[model samples]
Structure formats: C-alpha cells, structure tokens
Target: MKELLKRYKYAPADQLPSYCIPITVNGKTCGRLRPITPDTLHSEEEIRLLTEWRSASGEWFTTQFPVTEHGTRQWLEQQVLQADDRILFFVDDEDWNPIAQVGFLHYDEVKKQCEFDNLLRGRKGRFGNIMIYALLALGEWSIRVLDLQTGYLNVLADNARAIAIYKKLGFQEETRTPLVKQVEGDVTRWVVAEDDDTGGEAQRYLVTMKVRTEGFYETLKQIL
Candidate 1:
C-alpha cells in the first residue's frame, strides 16, 4: 500500500478504491485518503461542504471562488480533472465519511515541480496533525514516483499558524510578494481560525516556499 501511493497517478480512475491511504493525527483517527472518484465529482453534499469551508477560510484562500453547488463542481473539473492533476479526498477510514479535500495544482512534468493547492482541513480542530501527515506523505510521494525534484506552495505570510506548520514539515521560504488584489466585491473584513493570529489581515504577503526532493524524505524522520 505504501509503495502504491507513489504511482496511483497511473491507476484507472475507477479502480482507485483499492489504493486508499490511511491518515491519522496524534494517534487519533483523522481519516483515510484516496483518489477522487465519479461520486465526488457530482456529489452535492461535497460541493456544499467545500464551498462553506472555503468561504469560512477567507484570509487563506486567494480567489473569489464559485459558491453554488453546480459552479463548484465545474471548478473542480477544470482544476483537478482537465488540469491533469491528481486530487485526493480525505475521508473516514471506518465508514468512508468525507472529512476534507486536497490535491496538486499545476504539476509540470517537464519542470519537475508543482504547486500544492486546495488543501483544506476538516472541522475537527483537535486532530490538527492531519495536515502535517497529509503534506508529508504528498511531498514524499511527489519525489519518490512522480520524478519531481521540488515541491512548492503559497501561503499568506500573515497566516503564522500555517507558516509554522509548513516550516516544521521542512519547507523553507524562497520568495515573498504582495498577493494579487482579491476582486471579490467590497472585501472588507475576513475571518480566520486562529485567535491572536498575527500577520493575517488586510496586509497579507503571498509567500512562496519550497522543499527539495531529499528534504521531503528527510522530513519524515523529523516527524517520526
């Protein structure tokens, strides 16, 4: 199962169920992660959940995304399906309950680099370690099988909590710039999860960071 995760990109989309990957946080049940399927592509419930969660996480997300269920599904197809990216769903290991969603964005096979995107955490805050494990595994898999030499991701510079987590996972700052202006109508106030979370407000930096292929595998040692 461990080796299979690195090569699931070639698996027939319909046969992805057999390649499910287990994920846990703090030794507690977080969920199982598997490749996206036809069910997730059309499920209205998932559409609602992702839309609501993205809206709630205003300061973190970049764009003014689609809000309606149909619109969200369309966006998913463009971003994950047509974009040649592998999207995975975070679900309960026992009963197959949906927990969250994550995926690679703009993975350039020739460049040997990719941007990680759509990584939203579930509502269970106490089991926060889920993000760490998810990212660690993804980073390892990227280098191990995808022939990737580097992994890149962007985060709000003001999002200290997320930045800290990224650092702990062995990602280091590579560049920083102001994020493109959000075109959402009358954007005034934004909501975030962390209380007293500094550096996340009207003034936000679009920080780009990366972890080398070797560093990704090395991170596993730190976490373990």
Candidate 2:
C-alpha cells in the first residue's frame, strides 16, 4: 500500500495508475474523483482555477491567507505532488471538468489511520451531493486499497451543514477542542489553545470525527 501511494505521488500524471471513482445516479454517470497531479494541472487556466477555489474557500480552513497563482503552483509542486503522505483528488463532472477538491493526509503506517483533508466545493449548487459522494468514495478506497484501519476529519463545531453531512456518512464525533486565532503578517492560523489562554472566549471550536474501516464500505453502500 505504501509503495502504491508512493507511485501515485511521484509518477508523472500521464504515467500514473488509474484511480477514479465515478458518481452515478439511476444508472447514468454524473461525476468522478480523479487524482490531482502537477502534470494534471500544468496549464495556466488550471492553476488559476485552483487558486480561485482555494481563496474562495478560506473561511472553512484552519489557515487563512490570500491565495495566488504562484503560491498555488508552488504548493502543488512541493506540498502536494512531492509529499509522501498526502494525496488529493479533483471532484470533476462527467465531462472531466474539476468542480471541487478532496483528499487525505497524515497517514500513519503503524496505526493505519489517516485524516481526510482539503475538502472544498469550488462550484456551488452545480453538484449539490457531489462532495458527499467524493468523500465516501475516498473513504472506501483508503480502507480497501490502502488497508487503512481508521479515517478521521476535523471540522468547525459551528459548521452545521458540514457536520450534518459527516454524520450522515457515519463519522462520529471524537473530540471538540477550543482554538485560538493567531495572526502573523498576511496570515492567520487557528491553533489549539488551552481554555485559559483564550480567557474563556475561544475564537472557535474544532470538532474531530472518526470512522472505523470495518464499517466504511457498509456506510458507502447505505448511502448509495
């Protein structure tokens, strides 16, 4: 599994192995989840779209910073494509146009656990339930193909919409920790801070949720 992940990460996009999850409704294909690679997004327009999407979804993330094409391209090359433990996929329409991004990171080889990270729906209202399908597909793939024992994700406690969707997908809350916002020039980071550090008025609460690999496929089946 580790070797497979390494190949997926380092291989050129054209030479990469096929790993796609198709979204279907009533026997008709609707969208897919395709792996994101540097080669897959070498075009200027692709980088621009990714930058715009990341910038637009800033409110839901732990780090807030102005996203730019240059930074996004660098991140794609360094942080994503070259990282050994991270893999991101594009949520695309049936025609293969990217609509959103979803992926996993922080994989623990000994524990067989990983966190589902970088989930953002760039195109709103176009595919209402596409993100849900994308997550389910990713979860199933991780458990079955990668032999992951557990998968988890963190969400803002006040994000009712995302929490509700996560509940429906069979993730149960594990913890809720207070977070404090720390600002550094041109950037703001949400860090887990002690209750006393925030003077009883923390900036936000981060809710961590986990799902067991044994029940992952069953949950996907129920949703489908």
In lDDT terms, which candidate is top? 2
Give Cα distance to truth, residue 32, candidate 2, Å: 1.6
Over 47-166, each residue of candidate 1 has an lDDT whose tens digit, in order, gives 788677677775576655445667677766665555455455554434566666666766677788888777777565345466677666666666766788888898888889888988
Q: What lDDT tens digits, residue by residue, belong to model 2 across residues 108-144?
A: 8899999988888888435678788778778877877
Model 1 TM-score (2 dp): 0.77
RMSD of 1: 6.6
TM-score of 2: 0.91
lDDT of 2 at 179: 94
